[model samples]
Target: MMNFRKAATAAGLVLGIVTGLVGPAAADVPAAIKERGKVLIAIDVSHPPYGMLDSQARETGSDVETAKLLAEDMGVALEIVPVSGANRVPSLLSRKVDMVIASFSITEERKKVIDYSRPYGVIPVVISAPQDMGIAAPADLAGQALAVARGTTADIELSRIVKESGVNARIVRYEDEATTNTAVATGQQKILAAALSTANEVSEQNPGLNLEVKLDMAAYPMAVGLRKGDDELKAWVDEWVGQNLENGKLNAIYEKYFHQPLPDVIPES
Candidate 1:
């Protein structure tokens, strides 16, 4: 059995090599990407609905599927590289991955370090708490424990709100969205700030927890992130996004994972 597995792996590698050499080159692709014959996309595998591992430990989610589609459209193989929120930008900057599609929100602060494609989707950062927690607003979070994945948009916005509003909430930072949601569901934390889609999944998975969105911190436009000034790759990605948006291909991917229609708030540009 082991020998058969090994032989199968070897055969697949040979097939890939042959295909890479003979496949039609994607037009207008960056030279580096074209030479590689594959696009390495960085994704936050711990963030469900956006990106996550399935029961078989294979990457599956909206962003993962979208990445696959983009690679197909580009006539290349797709390679997914798992990354954490804090390390995604650094991963791209270090040339570890060709691009990032990890629900990367476009922000003025991030634009200084990396270039972004046009908005592909929108996600709201929301504050959620147990139904009985009495946390109805951001101001109500004062003196309560709030869990958030460090380095995420939720963490940044929640921290800013606490500081600016003089809310003395205890911000408990976790390594990733899964852990943060677990903390809340297990009653270790009474409040959590996370993407709405993530919160919805957590609530659905742990129905007994009865988590409810208490406040919406902000709505952010998400886009693909490329290394700064990589004009060729950035332009290709932006054009892909535009075409997908118009053709309804992107919306179909979103609806598959989210189990709902894509929100109208997604910016066309």
Candidate 2:
């Protein structure tokens, strides 16, 4: 479903432009961002509870609210650039976005290119289906088809597990989270590999469908992704996260969407 060759080619196409865009200001980005008077942030609005569009097409979610707060703190305008999970890094690298505050989970592979603020949230990744499916273990997924959003860490990890374990399941990758969720909710697909919050959104939106989490893949720490070498910007963002987290502002945002308070201490990646 995912064309790895195409992805590689796309990355190559952007490499030259991204390299040119990474100037000295990329290292001292806080001053540059202030001078610009607006901070560009990339977010995946297709992912619900974290980032999504409301009924009126306004961006409203935990991540969106958090970005607003960050902008207010910086005394800058907030510009949200819509992005798919696959292009977040490319957007940041090309200077299309100052940072990414979507459910940008920190991972070893991603860290090789971008710096990340200490984690602000933990999101659970899971494989979900109706209660009747009873997916109790990895073996239960064998020969089954699971809908997944393309290029998400959940998709990458799920693919790894399936391949390494020699499971015969099929991974149906969609262009975005909304499509993946729609496929499962509409009965076009029987199972979903996505965040716990995403699966919950699908079930909530389509009340008649009783989608339920059947397997807990893992809980990932989400952070703000910054350009590599932007130590000053990263430090400022880390401090901002700590202040909001300690004062309960971040937890308040989390509770608004998650319906529960954040943990006393958000685990670091």
Worst 10 residues of 2 by lDDT: 20-29
For 1-269, candidate 2 gives per-residue lDDT tens digits of 43433433343346326644222222234888889999998988888878888889999999899999988877789999999888888999998998999899888889998899978888888988887887898888989999999878789779987988899999999988888888988899988888888888787887777778888888888899999988878867766675566556888999999999776556677
TM-score of 2: 0.87
Q: Which ten residues in a row have the lowest lDDT in candidate 1?
A: 18-27
Name the TM-score of candidate 1: 0.87
lDDT of 1 by residue, 164-266 (tens): 9898889999988888878887878877789999888888888888888988899888899898878877767766775666567887997787777666546
Among these predictions, the greatest lDDT belongs to: 2
lDDT of 2: 0.82
